[model samples]
Each structure stands twice: as structure tokens, then as C-alpha cells.
Target: MLKKLVLIGGGHSHALVLRLFGNKPLSGVRLALITPDIYTPYSGMLPGHIAGFYSYSQCDIDLQSLSNFAHAQLCLDHVIGLDLKNRKVLCANQPTVDFDILSINISSTPTKLSVPGAVEYTIAAKPVAQFLEHWYQLQENAVRNPQKALNIAIVGGGDVELALSILAGVRKLEIYLFQSSKELMPSHHQSVRRIMRDILSNQDVKLHLGERVCEVVKLINKGLTIKCESGLMVTCDQVFWVTHASAGSWLKAAGIGTDDQGFILVNDNLQSVTHPHIFAAGDIAKMINYQLPKAGVFAVHKGNPLYENLRSMILGESLKPYKPQTAYFSLIVTGDGRVLANRAILPLPSHQLWWCWKDCIDRNFMAQSPHQ
Candidate 1:
């Protein structure tokens, strides 16, 4: 009997797996990919795309062609739940998909809050697809009404500096960033954080640190009002939520073994601790022994190991363990052809040379697709 292998999301890891499988096929193994978007945008270049440095087509991974090359059915639907006991996959549009092996690479989302108009007014900026859609529409609105006072609010800390710097180029609008903590990018080097803070202030980007938004009220014919728990109110044209990262809500309800944050718990082999038949990678998974920060580079590197382990598991062979590196270089686009990078305690100041290096890396990584 042929074995069924279903990949839940077209994330970086799964995309790499598809490319590898396209080159080498495991006998009697049927593969399929389930994702909501036909083109999964690469996070490495997403900030550039939003900043207007890169075009939409440049940063997006062509999932359709990749699936075709891998000889996998690309199911254009959202995975709503899983029938774990029956070893079946549940989706929003398609019928139940039964699989011998399942690998989930779905990325995490911001923990949805129950603010006044948050559900209706705020946009969660993870999972990439929805944020892209939301930005496009908002950009159009801003372009059409040049005379309208435009105020954009982003609620999140750390690395969001990259986003705010680039988003300043998106339009001639007042951009505000709010972090609940007193300090931004707390994990980063103090010098690097100070440099970013200076850059934002110099760019006229309003900074509201230590103010956590508790509610959002959509003003009729005006804009949206954001109320912070710190007794502050600000109205903006759009509110983007990039709060704490949390995985799919359905994972817990479906009885999947996940961490406190709702990410699937997997062993070093990337197999679920409780259910060996299920595997997870990327931001959607957490390693039981050593946890990896939610980074695209880690996901990119996990591709080969995940493919090897999957092949090993299906063939009744010993599964090789995948040990993620303790540290990796970080390339952050500053939205103006300059980049800031750091690896471990070493930090590189903002410079165009770093930007060139980052652009080269991103382009090279994106250029590998057989068809993109």
C-alpha cells in the first residue's frame, strides 16, 4: 500500500522539502501540500516588500509551481482542525484528508485579544498572507486620499524596528510604534537598540513605549481609536497587532501535543513526542530539548534534516536527529538600502554594505526555486 504524506503549510521548511522531493521521490509515497495562499511570501524579504524596496512577485514563493514539480497535490484551503485519532487532516474547504505521515509547518500568529474593536479593527501581522492583503488595501486607500490625515499604529516590540523603518517609506503618513515594555528589543545589544531608537526618532516616527493597547474603537467616518491600558488614547487610520507569538488555536482543541504557546512539541528528529506519525517544523513547532527562536534561517536549515527524517521514518530506518545551531546571523533591512545585523553578542552597525549582503542572501535563497 502507498503511504500518504501531507504537509500542512507552505512555509520555508515545507517548501524546501517539496523541492527536495521533486528531485528524489520515495517509492510508494504520495505527497500533498495544504496552504491558504498560492504564493507564500518569504519573511526575509517581507520588510523590503512592505517598505517598497522589493516588488510583491520578488519576495513571494511560488507554491503552485513548486507543488507541481514535487508531484504533490496543492490543496488551496486552510487547515481548521485535525482528526488525530483517525490520522486524518481537516481543512476549511476540502474534505478530510487521511495520511500515513503528517508534517505541519504552519507559522504562528499573534495572540488574538478581545479588545473593544480589536477583532474588527486590528490586523495580525504574522502568517504573512493576511498582513500582505491588509497592507495592499490600506496602501490603496492612502494613495487615493492624499489629503487625508494618515496615522498608522503598530503594536509590538523588538525587530518591529525593521518594519517601522521600512514602512515609513510605504507612504507619507505618521507612523507610531507602541511596545508594552519600557525598553524595545530587550534581547538585542544595548547599542543596537539605541541606534534603532535614534533612527526612528530622526525619521519622525512616533514611539510609544510602555503603553499596551487594551482596546480599539472604530470611529464612524473618521478613524480607529486605540486605548492603551496605561490610560492613553490614540486614533489611527490603521492598527497592526504584532504582539506575542502564538500558534494555531485548533491545535490544542484537537488534542495535539503542544507547548504553552500552542506550538507542536517535537523531538530532535522533528517527530511529535506523543505521536510518532506526526511531525512539525518551523515556527509551528517547538523542540522538546532545545528550543529554537522563531527565525526563518532555522526553518530554512531544517529542510534537509526534516526530509531525511521523514524518508527514514517511512522506510523503517533509524531517524537521524536534527540539532539546530545555537546562533545564526540576523539581517534586518532598514528600508533605505541600509541593514543592521547581529550574531550572538556581536552587532554590526547600520551600513549599506550590510544591506548589500542581506539583499544578496535573500535573492540567492529566493533564486533557488525551479519556478518562481
Candidate 2:
């Protein structure tokens, strides 16, 4: 009998695994993919999409097509919960699935930081589908109501916050970036930080640093008012929350050995610490040896190792460890064909040609059909 391999979430890592495993058949292994959407958006190109640099069709990976090529069954349903003890995966609409091996690659969600109205008023940036939909609606509204001043507040300090800055260029909106940390892009070098700050300044984007949001209140006539710990209040039409990315709630309920933040804990082999039959990759998997950033590049890089490990586990062979790179290139577009490149140093000046280079890279990445 063929071993059943069920993959939950069509995230970058799992998508690569699907493609690799499908292309070179994993001996006697059957594949199944469960995800909420058929198309998975590439995060690296999202800023470009928001900046009008790329179309939606250019950034999305058609999971259906990939699955068809992989000969994998695609289940378009949300995995609400899991019964780890029973070795069954629970879903919102479809029947539970039994598997000989399992892998999780679901992306994270924004942290519900207990700030009073954030849950009700602020929009999370992690759920790509919902955020993309909201972005389109915001753009439509902006075009329809050109006279109204669009005051938007981005609550976070990370690469996503930088991406949001690029998005501001396309909109006639007054943007404010709120960061509880003293420095933006805390993980990046000072030079890169200065460059980003200069970019935001040039764009007329306000930065509220070292201030924590105490409460978020929705006003009746006005929009949303965010009260900070410093006794300052900011009123905005829309709030974008891009904070710490938390793992899927289903993983926690499923008794996975996850961190307090809900990210699944995995060994170097990408096997779950708690469940030997299970594996994890992408943002959902936390490396025990090294702390890797939850970037798409890391996930994409994990594809080969995960594929090998899965095959090894099935073939009763020893698993291999996955080592992450210490540094990788970071290219950020400024919406108007200008870009900032950072790897070892701060943001280096990148002009339209750099943007074109970045565009080519992203397009090439998206063009690689996992199915083929």
C-alpha cells in the first residue's frame, strides 16, 4: 500500500515540496494538499503589487494547476482543528483525513496584542487573501472619493512595514507608521534603517517610534482612534496591523509542540519535536538550531531539504539537517521604480534599473510552475 502524505497549507515551503516530490516521485508516497485558497500569493512581490508594479495574476501561484501536475488531491477547505492522537486532520467543511505522514506550512497571523479595539478596527496583514481584498477596496474607495484625506496607520516595525511604505505611494493618503521599538527594521543595520527613514520622510510618512498602542477605539462619526501608552491619540481612517506573526490556532489545539507564540517547533530535519510522524516548514516551523527569519526566501530554500527528508523518512533512511544562510539579499521597491538593496550593509541606492532587475527576479520566480 502507498504511504499517504497529507500537506496542510499551500505555503511556499509546502508548494516547493509538492513540486519536488511530484516531479521525482517519492517512492510509494501519495500526496494531498489542503488549503483555503487555490492561489497562493508570493509575499516578495506583494509590495510590488500594492505599488502597481505588478498585476495580481503576476504574483499568484495557482495551487490547482500545481496539484494537477503533482497528481495530488487538492482539498479547498480550512483546517480548523486536528486530532493528533487519532492521527486525523479536521476540516471546516470536508471529512477528516487520515495520513501516514503530515506536514504543515500555513503562514502566521497577526498577534492579538490585547490592545482594546485592534481586533475590531485594525486589519491584519498576514492573511494575504483578505489583505489583498481590503487593499483593492481601499484603492477603489480612494479613487471614488478623491477629495477625502486618506489617513492610514500602519502598526508594526518590520519588512512588511517597509513594504507598506511602498504601497503608500500609489494612494493619496497620509500614512503614519507606528513602532513600539526605537528603531525601524530592528533586525537591519543602522544604515539601512537611516535609508528607510529617509525614504519615509521623503514620502511625507510620519514615524511614531517607541510608543506602544494602549487602546484602539472606533469612533462613531470619525474613524478609529488609537491611544498610545504616551497619552497620545491618533485618529485614522484605516489601521494596518503588521506585528509578530502567530501560528495557526489549529496547531495549538492539535497538541503540536509549538512555542508560546504558537509556532511549531521542529528539529534540523524539519520533523516536529513532539510528533515523529509529522514535519513542518516555512513560517510555521521554528528551527531548533538557528533562529531564521520568517521570510519567503527561507521557505523556498527549505523545499529541497524537506523533500529529501520526507523521502528519507518514508524509505527508512537517515534524515539530513537543513542549514540556513547567515545573510541574504533584501531588495525593497519604493513604488515609483526606485529600490533599496540591503544584504551586508544598509540600503544601497537602486534606481529604475534596479527595480527592473527586481521585477525580473520576481517574475521569474513566479513563472516557475511547481507543477511542471
Q: Tell me, by lDDT, which candidate is best.
A: 1
Predicted candidate 1 versus true structure: per-residue lDDT over 1-372, tens digit per residue: 798999999999999999999989778899999998899999888888888888988998999999998899999999999888898989897799999999999889887565567778889888688877888897788789877767888888666644565465566788888898899777777877887888787778788999888888888876889899989998888888888789878998889788898989999999999899999999999999995778888999999999998888788899999988888787766777788888877778779999888899889988888683
Q: How many residue pairs clash in each candidate?
A: 0, 0
Candidate 1 lDDT for residue 319:
95
lDDT of 2 at 57: 85
Off by over 4 Å in 1: none
The count of backbone overlaps in candidate 1 is 0
lDDT scores for all predictions?
A: 0.85, 0.83
lDDT of 2 by residue, 132-178 (tens): 88888888888899887788888886754444544553467788788
Reference-based lDDT, residue 232, model 1: 91
